[model samples]
Target: MSEIVFRSRFDNGRRKAFERSPKVSLTSPDFYFSHCFGVCRKKTSMGPPGIIWVASRVTQPDKLSEERFCEWYEGQHIDEVTALSGVPAAARYEAVPMSELAGPPTAETIKAAEQRPDYLMGGKWLTIYEMKDVDFRHTAEFKSLDGQSKPKGNLLDEIFTKAHFETRFGALLSNDDKGIKKGPGKLIISATMTPGSRASAEDIEQFYEREHVAEIAKCPGYVRTRRFRWVDTTVLKEFERLPADPIEPGNSVVALHEFEGPYFPMEGLLKADETPWTARVLESLKKNGIEAGFYRLKRVYGEWLPGSSKL
Candidate 1:
């Protein structure tokens, strides 16, 4: 569980509120709300979390227009997806642009010193859907989501930027819930990897779960994380996609690292418990190292809103 401590009065109120809301009552234990990560929850009590992301873009400049993209997402797409059996929770986020990546280390720009040009093939505005297993993408509900099960209005899909409307899958590897009030950060720093010729995917995955995450938690603003692979997609239908779609390649690796930050310092991570394995891991991926991006919170909406929305 998250290290979210509340005053006795507040806790009692939250419990009472949870008891009152039918949705909250039915979703308790499965959906634990937190501020650090907007409306996040584990897919299962003891299993890997299935992570999928969708990207969208802005259309106009008013509340109805500016947030229409998000509204369609939160109100329609997210609601439909999370309503599935065994599917406990879901969340959405906006990718923080380079303009906001100010201060010491990030001031230089996350991609300015681009060593791997082809890796950060993600979107600026993204939403993540978490489920009980990677196979949830293959469920009857998801089949509808894939445009293979059923169809009707599909209004939300109409507002999205087709090109930016990319999707990717990830298998939960490590999560550190001990850091702060919620997740470790106010921001999510991602590094999607492409294995090099000499790199062993098996070895890197094992090291990441066993050693890398624990070491990363030592960083100053570090929090929790959810790591997944492109292979974690639907077991049945292969998604039809544009040629430029990143996930279409089916050979990407993602690690969404959360941090309590105005920024996640590269030096901070390097300085945190610099074991010999850290250097080895770095050296291993040198051929095609981490292609990173920082995603910030845009707006969060769920059935438990106005109450646990701030939770």
Candidate 2:
């Protein structure tokens, strides 16, 4: 852990506090809410990081507006307080067409998209990014060199080459045809890495350095990226399981990259083409003696908050 450099807009005090204590209270909703509300209010005023909740659609699917969202819960709005408390700045990013999400959607995909915690980083539409950590400055490896000579071209790009890139031929048609709209076709790509026993903080830094990040960013159709440092905690059973008591982090850091192009990148034709790309990338990894990681993918509902100027 060379200092965790967050590419977010959170205030200094909150960032420092989270850095000091990354644990979230699981048992004490009241205490958690108070802290969360304060942070939310502060962020609302100063424009801090907005929290994204990642609840299962099956468990709690009906979407709610901010007012309703607060009403439905027993605890105070943690968004404001947490933002104020140095939990990292908070923001409310609503979906332009959030409700459009549907699926063979499974928990694995949802969990994959939410490489970080669902409580702090989740919300309606399977919250993806809070927009704070848009840069690729988090733990993840995007490259793998197979035993073959590291090719001059990327395996994925090669697979989706113009010659073989037609949808009929099992190529993913480009989203370029649909035109870029607010929430259409944006999917989240989440990668998680649990350091081996000997891994150190410095090792973490080297993993996400510019080289790896740039490659991930350069991946075929990435929209934006969000990286999260799990406040001290491990992977719990679900959002309802934590003790509500502030504690050490048990989970690993999570990095989310949004890929919103005209077509879905990993399905049907796209997936057909990607399979080989993945093989080549993995082979590359084996050759390079690097570890491969498990990844999750999700087609989620994301919206731009009302009156938000950035959309």
Q: How much lDDT does each candidate structure score?
A: 0.49, 0.30
lDDT of 1 by residue, 1-311 (tens): 00001101113455466457554331233332221112223345444555565555443333226455555556665666667663445556666655444454464565574453454534556666565665555433544452332123543234422223445555555554556546225677777665553355666677777887777777777666566666432211111223322332235567777777676555766664387765666566635455676777654434321111122
What is candidate 1's TM-score against the reference?
0.61
User: Candidate 2: which stretches are off by over 4 Å?
Assistant: 1-53, 59-125, 128-185, 197-201, 232-251, 262-311
- Candidates' TM-scores? 0.61, 0.35
Predicted structure 2: clash tally: 56
Off by over 4 Å in 1: 1-48, 58-66, 102-118, 146-151, 154-157, 160-163, 197-199, 206-211, 232-240, 243-251, 265-267, 270-289, 300-311
lDDT of 2 by residue, 1-311 (tens): 00011112234585466567656553354333323222322112233232232322122223223343333221322232222222332222232221122345467666665454322322232322233322111112101112011223442122111111000000010111222333422555434344333344335445455333544555556554444444322111212222312211232344544555533344332343244433443243212222111123333223433211232
Looking at candidate 2, the ten consecutive residues that score lowest on lDDT are 164-173
Q: What is the Å distance of residue 94 in model 2 from its true position? A: 13
Query: What's every prediction's RMSD, in angstroms?
Result: 14.5, 18.4
Residue 258 local lDDT, model 2:
50
Clashing pairs in 1: 170-228, 171-228, 184-223, 185-259, 185-260
Residue 248 lDDT in candidate 1? 22
